[model samples]
Target: MAIIKLSETKLQELKEVCKSFNNDKGELINVLHKAQSIFGYLPAEVQEVIAKELNVSVAHVYGVVTFYSFFTMTPKGEHPISVCLGTACYVRGAEKVLEEFRRILKIQVGQTTPDGKFSLSCLRCVGACGLAPVVMVGEKVYGRVSPDGVKDIVAEYRN
Candidate 1:
């Protein structure tokens, strides 16, 4: 992983976010969410800054960040693609759909395309079991996705 340098402006914004929460250690999760929003992802440098501001240990902050699935240390692509691997989706062929995405994008799960247009990931459930084998591109949900349809889905955002 490459080291990230936070700009003074961004660093100030993060400090402001912490201050907004009164730098309360109890609001660590909320602080992390705001920090991630500011930085796109919680890199180690950002984590360190957050730790100092919240008066918490760096290890504690890192533990919280890693423990939550919603938080990502790496940056996500402009279009983050997520596959549902819950019991219903998996039984309905979610794995095949995920493979199709990897084949088409030429990137594995938790990887972003070279062009930074898309990134792939998997989640246990999307709560859309009725529409098994689901895929999500950013905020739009595509239910009942098939391996064959993966190409069209990728093409839809190519332009």
Candidate 2:
């Protein structure tokens, strides 16, 4: 898991987001989202806080975070790179592209760089099979990628 550094303002914001639910029982998931929004992923401390405020069990809250795809307990990189591994993308060489990213980044999927520059991950499909072998860096999408193109593609964001 990546370590999360939170500012006092952000911590207050998390509490505020949790408070908006107005109901301790129904606000669990909502608070989780707010926490994730502020921190990118929920750290253990955030989960503990939410559990204490909502009167929920820490195990229960942790379970929810672990079960949901949207929740990430680990800290993500500055730019999260998600590669598509859908059948179309796979046939188009998405695996090779992922390998290239791993090699260059020197980190496995779901990991952030020591410098906190990028995090690499994979998905089934970005729903853009026509652009098989697609990769998304944050909101921007790169399609029809090749293994050789990984470095250049990632480089565009470094600057």
Candidate 3:
């Protein structure tokens, strides 16, 4: 795969973050967190730089990244849309709601829109069974979402 090169300023900034962490290999997760915050996502090239700085194998870094569900290698859109797919949600027609989002957004789960305005993903549960079919855009949550309500929800973010 081709490397995504980092600019000089970004490279220097990432180095500073490592320096702040003392470059201890045990702080790999913390380093990765700061790196992701700086770069938006943890790409292969960034991971390579981190591995070298932290004095650990790239494989080890990759292992830790993949182990955590919160870590993502791809960039997310400004509005990250998530649909709940827990047992309660599934039973309450969340599948149809998810399909509507995919149909309208034209992107599959884990994919961001070409314009980088929105992303689609599925989560197991949000601990809101009372509102089983819950959809989240950023931190805001919409409960009892239905397929018909999808267009309005998508439109609200169009601007």
lDDT of 2: 0.88
Off by over 4 Å in 2: 1-5
Model 1 C-alpha lDDT per residue in residues 45-135, reported as the tens digit of each score: 9999999999999999999999998898988888999999999999999999999999999999998898889999999998999999899
Provide the RMSD of all predictions against the true structure, rounded to 1 decimal: 2.2, 2.0, 2.4
* Alpha-carbon runs more than 4 Å astray in model 1: 1-10
- Model 1 steric clash pairs: none
What TM-scores do the predictions have? 0.84, 0.90, 0.83
In candidate 2, position 42 carries an lDDT of 87
| Cα lDDT listed for each candidate | 0.94, 0.88, 0.92
Error of 1 at 24 (Å): 1.9
Give the lDDT of residue 138 in candidate 2.
Answer: 93
Candidate No. with top TM-score: 2
Flag clash pairs in model 2. Answer: none
Output the better candidate (1/3) by TM-score. Answer: 1
